[model samples]
Target chain A: MNRVKSKYLKGKEKFAIGIDLGGTNIKIALVSKAGAIRNYLKIPTNTQQGKEATITRIKQGIYQIISQSNLETRSISGIGIGAPGPLDFQKGIIHFAPNLPGWEEVPLAEIIKEEFKIAVKVENDANVAAWGEKTFGIAQGVDELVCLTLGTGIGGGLIIGGKIYHGKNNVAGEAGHIVVNKDGPLCNCGNFGCLEAYSSASGIKNRVSRRIKELKISDPSIFYQNNFDQISLVKIFEQAREGNPIVKDIVEEAIEYLGIGITTLVNLLNPEMVVLVGGITNEGDKLLNPVKDIVFHRAMRYHVADLKIVFGKLGEYAGVAGAAALLWDFD
Target chain B: MNRVKSKYLKGKEKFAIGIDLGGTNIKIALVSKAGAIRNYLKIPTNTQQGKEATITRIKQGIYQIISQSNLETRSISGIGIGAPGPLDFQKGIIHFAPNLPGWEEVPLAEIIKEEFKIAVKVENDANVAAWGEKTFGIAQGVDELVCLTLGTGIGGGLIIGGKIYHGKNNVAGEAGHIVVNKDGPLCNCGNFGCLEAYSSASGIKNRVSRRIKELKISDPSIFYQNNFDQISLVKIFEQAREGNPIVKDIVEEAIEYLGIGITTLVNLLNPEMVVLVGGITNEGDKLLNPVKDIVFHRAMRYHVADLKIVFGKLGEYAGVAGAAALLWDFD
Candidate 1:
């Protein structure tokens, strides 16, 4: 038999290259079919070096991972990338992400495929994370799943009937934009009263900054610093745990709005599991318990009966893992 | 070949029996494969007379339609039922419905199949309506569809990836209960500020009545009557069109909230079309225009780019047509 016939005939060529392209860092990994990270590497993106340099760096990273792991290039099942988007997955184009400045319709997949002489796939960052969780993390074996990446801004990913549901135009799963309060506050998406405005990290900090001014609590050293811009989520949570009044209400409201937003998702999608990922998940049970209580209490009775709301097990590796999984069949 | 061998050997055996179970009436029809209603039957439910009577009436109606249409029992595809839910579409059991009193775990499909000796399917009413629209009505050929039944209550049916999405347990499409204004008004589902409270027929009437009491508009004959309970939606819309204060704000708010609720759905589900159905559709452009305006301007740009927001074309026959379509494989 020819080498091409051994693609899966021998059934041991079970590795894939996964790449997570972030504004600050690029994470690349050599992952096995069973989801083990055989080799991993992280490098600074240094986006200021421009798109070409970033592309060159990614190619170098891919080579480094393969060589360090001592794996043959043919034994690998190509490369998969997860990046910030409004990008086209089918075309593998980056259609100008907010964080990835100057990236306008760059076909990253084609570039990588040309270098590697193998398959290459690219997906939205949030979707990649959700896929990672569904494939090998907390949501393993769960068909209907929702993954929320709560970082600087909230992002949502949906898995329906065990398949990634990239709406009609690949623009579905805008869960963070669900309007929880129709007239509450402005969101980054230019809408008012979005769930993101109330629950996201940026929104929480902005709320605190605005509330500090509105309430005229200038001496905010109890929780925040003299500089409103210096207010970190960690300090805010610490103060809330200590019952510092300035931070308590804001933290509690964030939790409440997050709960309400999640309840809306639970009611709408009726997913088997909701996996929480990103910075906000670090708060752990403090953030998760109340959100669960509200969803269980507020969502339709049948939806909550067997539903699970938990943190994603993959953590930072989700982007890399899920991106790599793009080349693998879901089974 | 025996008679059974002709199931699909001859495509001419294309008739299906459809039964729409409602609080006021049971609509039964003999529908052909080409979306034509060969014979239609309507009967008053007289729900006060109880379940057995209703089921018998349904059976009698089915027999009448088949006889009237001159369709042979063997030629008919099967029987399909559309009923108020949370019903088990798979097991064909109705857990209970708010309108269908005392219908506890009724094995509707099993009961029908036992008598008829053919395939029988029971589905949630909203799902049936959505399926009907997808199969033979306004949403024909539209893959991602959202159908709204706007009557005493607002109901939602979803067609995701071209099939009716029943969520995890078939209790998925409760569009009416979407909490638009988290603090708006009390809904029948024991929730506050649900879209149903702001947009449903009963909710609209209730809002006007409460506003009359709150604002002390005792002389409501300019639109509503002295008997606050008789404040009909038709009168309310007419007065609102004429710019009457008592009815104008309430009507405008209803449309606005409905728009906002739908905008939320568009953002989340990214449906290609949203078909509005039921009594409120009588207002036509007056209702469709403002709702469309809000959704178009407020939802994510890509979601609205090619989205079609139109009135359901099936009219009163939607329930019957949709229920009947359950026995046919969706193209």
Candidate 2:
């Protein structure tokens, strides 16, 4: 273990249990008010077994952390859960979650609060990640910021006036669903030309597949002729780095569509910074430099004059940290 | 002319002076706290004479209103000006208003405040109109509303949480610049495929010219055989109402682009109401019914489920009414 410094809340040594609940696994962390992760553990959700079973495993994981750290439950201010959403944050109910089946209107907050006898808060996972970036990441103190997660599907959250902006109906930050190209492509939401159709991990993979087929027609002796099914976004990035024309074109097209989407967002919201997360940022300047170049060139001057296009710094810990930040809002 | 009720400040008999400064004329109105206009007047701006001359005209107008209404300056809460923008709202400086010559970085607010010894606020004309709709029109109690003015150019204002959302630099609501078609048409802002390029009054007129030329090739005896220059937006609307296929196609094309642009806004902002302003809306359901149908059909269901698309009720009074509403912000 690394020699960790104490970041407990002063005067009363307070802490929060941050739960990043997902389909495959549940990550529970003991996070101090100062944003230090004192103890952490992960447990398989096994959600297929049932919601109650997964809840039991989560509770056990929480108790395990408390016992290992020799801390009293009284010292923990609250438990914050950042879960997949389409949720009712006001009522602390999970209306529906695609990843976790049978999560229809489950009062997750109430269940946890009843079991642990501690205050609990539930929020959208993407929103928590945005708040996490603001609280303990590179975007600290940025009152107006946009955060995007580029994974299987693109999810986004807006931070306005230093808080998550849930629209009139709690569905405000659906940036992925905003149409970029009116006739470009169809999205899962049955909309034509959504930003997600060209920018998500799946979107990128589909591009790779289509580009390879087009290349094979032009040149019969192209690379990855037989192992096309194994061609991943990582392999595409590696191939682009190694100077493959087909992969380069694919990456450029995706980034161009992403740039157009971001330009629309800049025109509309005029956010101070746009923070990116997920595995795509591992490409570093390869992704950020081109996106910045295109977005700046396309967006209006005043809106982009002081804009910062950066990556989220907290890594995997962002979700848990943001969840814990919910306690601050509760206070 | 009409018997008006007092909407003055509850504790004090106070009113506000609202000036709608335009390229050709300046419309000034004395308005009570409840958004009732007690006195109004319009004067030629003669902007070509210079910024100082225009300032003098505006000052004289203010004095004339005070004298005509038999109201003392002390009873006026503030002077609010709604002018063409790219402005510095914080310092009340007009950065570069193209409509008004030699008006770069002119400190209008400071000069007005010094002369009147009263508070003064300067805002984008479109923003003021939106505020006016909220204060005195159909959207009086609607907090989240989007107001659009479709004239020679399209201007938009967003009321988020019941306040004007000034982006990081107070230039947030440039909705006209939002790209609807990435490769469609050129905008004055040097961008390709802007909403303004396809939906503005000039845009509509240009569509008529292009469509007329295209129709001449297919059919010679079209409506405007020789007098194309006299083909105004009103004429196009009138012709379309008469069931002219060429004119109808032109109007439908413009409305289609407008609908696409508005659909993007609905998906992004999820506002409760959208208020339409300007002459195009004078066509009533001819313009609105089709737009509403297209927009609702294209936009996400949740965003438009309970949405109300209506025309601004205050009509010409919106500018001055919105300007007066600026005083409420100061309070």
Candidate 3:
């Protein structure tokens, strides 16, 4: 095997392991400080097998990735895991993640450390993605940045002065639940008019379903036939792009709320850059341009002038990369 | 004079001059690092007298305060001036201040530094007050804090990681202008439903005046009629405290909007503490309790549990203390 040496690698060539634990899959990867993925592996989460079984799968995934690498596991710095929240980062516990069955105050970091005999850190998945973006993606070299992940639920992570700002109780960056329209819609968090209630994929679906019901359109029962399984965001986007008026209106409404949320973040953080990530961001400039335009128009001109809103470059690897970076820094 | 040695005064006690440049008056003081005010002087700010005359009066005010202090001029570290914005902190220029007539892009910091032969820093008055509160008042020992000052207009400052978080253009924290009520009221900034449009003293007066007009009450103007030389916040607070129905309703309405503003800050920064300062806070527990109740009730519960809300304790000396601390740390 040929060993590559470069200035960016430094002397020891530090490396770390990152695990992105999602509802459907568990992805593990070994990453370098330069954001290069050396070896990666993925496995079905099998969350239905319960927490203990799922934890075992996660360990196996890590081992599988490391075994494929030429570098010794000893040289691997530490391990970082990104899981859904609400989590207690200080305690390294997953408080209660709706997506992950039977996850309640799971001591994830300690469990992984005990199994592997290495330092382990855990953070909310969105925060980890933000960290990944800041260190390796669009926000590289920027001091203050905010990353918003638009998926089933809206998630946000704030980086201030190059460090993750986990507010008191590790819930500081819950931008999704921030009320944009106090009288708009009922949110899962029992709040009215939260950005998540309008901006999330599920939020969009709910809005569309409501509008469809009101218009007495032949029940698009196919949309919810498989418990929303057959309904994909891409399908909606495709329809909207093809001039489906109903889909167009729903997407436009979501964009309006997204703009409000973006403006709020701009006014509040005044960050150098705002990086948008997750499944919804795949819509590209179609969604980004309107959101940017409205945010700039609504926010104070002084704060908005230098603001840069861009799509996250790291894609699905963001979590694993960010987790690896965390290990590299702490270990 | 006997100078008692104390732990707080570890080195040769340094002093700094602070200038609060208001529309009506220029208040200058000699301040110690431990939040002590050695001497103070106030002078009329004759803006129509032109920039030169105003600068001359400011210099006189500084000299008068310094002369009254036991400290020598050579021992003074520097000077910190708090002025109205929009300002360029990096260039030390004030773009325009509505309160300060004819103040446009004035290089106040450079002018003062040149005259005194000492380093000078100029910041937005609200930001200075925030630093003042964080360094010596209610937010002492808290690393992440935000201070809100309510007057004719609402002003804000953000203290993140123990340093003021000035955004890309030095306009990071304009919390008052964050739109809470999207369809509520028109703000002077040309925005609809800004927190400043609802919470400021002038905002309260406007809301009360509108109600009186809508009700067609005879002698509606009597409520705001000049009792003596001024219409002060103290007068309004007294009327509300003494059970004036109209004034009480207006104050409650303002407090409701202020609560929303505070909740927005909590949601955004997840600050460890939020301190309320300015003339309006003189309502004490009456005003603070309602705001606290609303913020706690409305914000993410987990994030709000550790959040502390308190009234500023430094009173009028906050600017002087903050300025002194700024210079003392100048090295």
Candidate 4:
């Protein structure tokens, strides 16, 4: 009786509170029955205060959001959370999240349920974003999709057959760890040639640095006009946009690696859509077009024939929305 | 209703006929409620006679299985078939089977249902094998598994969350087409560096042929004791078992490629178990041990922490058993 059953929802409308637990901050939102955010609040996570104090802060944030919005507590049916992963999603326990120290086997959902007196569900952050995409964003109406969150580290979400696919250990859809090249580069995950090691923000930065160093070594005068120490993804993209050949080549190389990784997913999963979510989306066609070219030309014809490679529609709110989207399973 | 409802089978002792339709032959079996084969028979496919003739042969095979077993026709409640892909399993239609020429969008399940007056299900051969493995093979009790069939070509089956994972276009689980090496050999599927191109039977043959040619050019005296013109996978394994250094190197090289491919699967899927099927299994420990070594050493540690790599238990009859295992979905 703890879990909501589908048969109970004959005609009733229900709303849920969504919590996005990140390393720096926590974002809480009152998601309506129609998946619209009626109220939102942001607060620093302050994990240094320890687990009990952090839980207290989250509960306070929830109460504040409800009081500020003047909404009745009875109106909220459940609570959903999206948190850093490698956790036991089914058990709603944080099984040693790297970003959240001292959060080993933390019974998050159980505690939240106790505090709110409502059903609570917890999922991986990347998977929550994917659920948000499938329910309200670009992947709407798509039964199968692979969403990649390109940032300092790449995160993946696999929506297969209209549901988040949690494999044996709730570790499925680890596309970032997929090896693009057998002997390319070493990853922090202690693997060689992983997709994240080549296509992530840091990966791109490293590539650009290598290219700049090579160019500087060959012709020091070429880089004297620009601030070489200001090396970053934004700077590299800006330089590439201005037709800097070295920066452009670096961008192209990273795109090729991303395309290879995506192509691998296309061949293995054959998803209907592949949505890219992150700061990289700002480059638009410069990143998407070439990645699409390599994926289409490299993957099996039938798989890529109708596959849509697009940017995520939810943007920054994807995590919050996707966290709320978790209730869709019960609703 | 064309499909049987689970509720309708509350008290019925239902049985099913399982058929594995391959390019050269058809395997038919009467499967009981316990995933056991009661009666079995095999017949040549003779696909050249056209689709209608092939259907007739399949129908005849079914009748033979029933009549020979002296079983009541009413006892068999349904029929299931495992056919080559990439077919529309949901619709029971063959999109285009390269092996079974002339089969294009063929309504196989409906045709068989009409003839037998029973519910029928059709699935991809690799998927059927995966289901069979889940039901009665090494993957029993495992919720997530990846089954790889290595023969003339490589075929894959993805069992995620204890169910067959059919992505958007029913073309998922094409693990054979995964790019292991970006600039390796070309595959018949019109892609370069595919797992199939390096780990398949023909791929091994090509590698052995190249190794033989290289050895011959360097020193013909080593090959004077054996025939160099005849080269095959069977020959390579046989020679390697006798401590032939050249053949041992080729076998090891192929195993290295297989390891990389399996490592990729491990990192992406994080399956609880990986069941490898085909002639390669005949090599047994020679192949399994080395592949396990590389996968454990190369893949992410947490992903491969408790991974199980084993051979399919059903052997050549896996296709037929898998075909029968399709009924477990309904049961």
Candidate with top DockQ is 1
**Best candidate (score: lDDT):** 1
Off by over 4 Å in 1: A1-13, A213-230, B1-13, B221-229
TM-score-better candidate, 2 vs 4? 2
True contacts kept of 3: 0.51
- Candidate 4 retains true contacts at a fraction of 0.73
How do the residues B111-161 of candidate 1 rate in per-residue lDDT, one tens digit apiece? 989878888999988888998888899999998988999999888898999
Evaluate residue B281 in candidate 4 and report its C-alpha lDDT on the 0 to 100 scale.
85
Tell me model 4's lDDT, rounded to 2 decimals. 0.81
Give model 3 RMSD, 1 decimal: 4.1
Candidate 4, A213-254: lDDT as tens digits? 665655433433366554567677777778887777667667
lDDT of 3: 0.80
Docking class of 1: medium
DockQ, every prediction: 0.66, 0.62, 0.51, 0.62
The C-alpha local distance difference test score for the whole of candidate 2 amounts to: 0.81
Query: Which stretches in model 2 have alpha-carbon errors above 4 Å?
Result: A1-12, A207-231, A238-250, A329-331, B1-13, B207-231, B238-250, B329-331
TM-score of 2: 0.89
CAPRI rating of model 3: medium
Docking category for candidate 2? medium
**Which regions of candidate 4 fall more than 4 Å away from where they truly are?**
A1-15, A42-60, A111-118, A209-230, A240-249, A328-331, B1-14, B46-53, B209-230, B238-250, B328-331
In order, the candidates keep a fraction of the true contacts of 0.57, 0.51, 0.51, 0.73
Better of 1 and 2 by lDDT: 1
Q: Model 3, B1-331: lDDT tens per residue?
A: 2234433245666678988887777878888777778787777898889877998898888777766665455567889988887798777899888887778889998998887788788888888888888777888788788888877788888888788888767877888787776677788776677788888977776777677678886854446546533445666666777888867877776887788778767876788988888878878888889999888877876778789999888888777677666665531
Winning candidate number (TM-score): 1
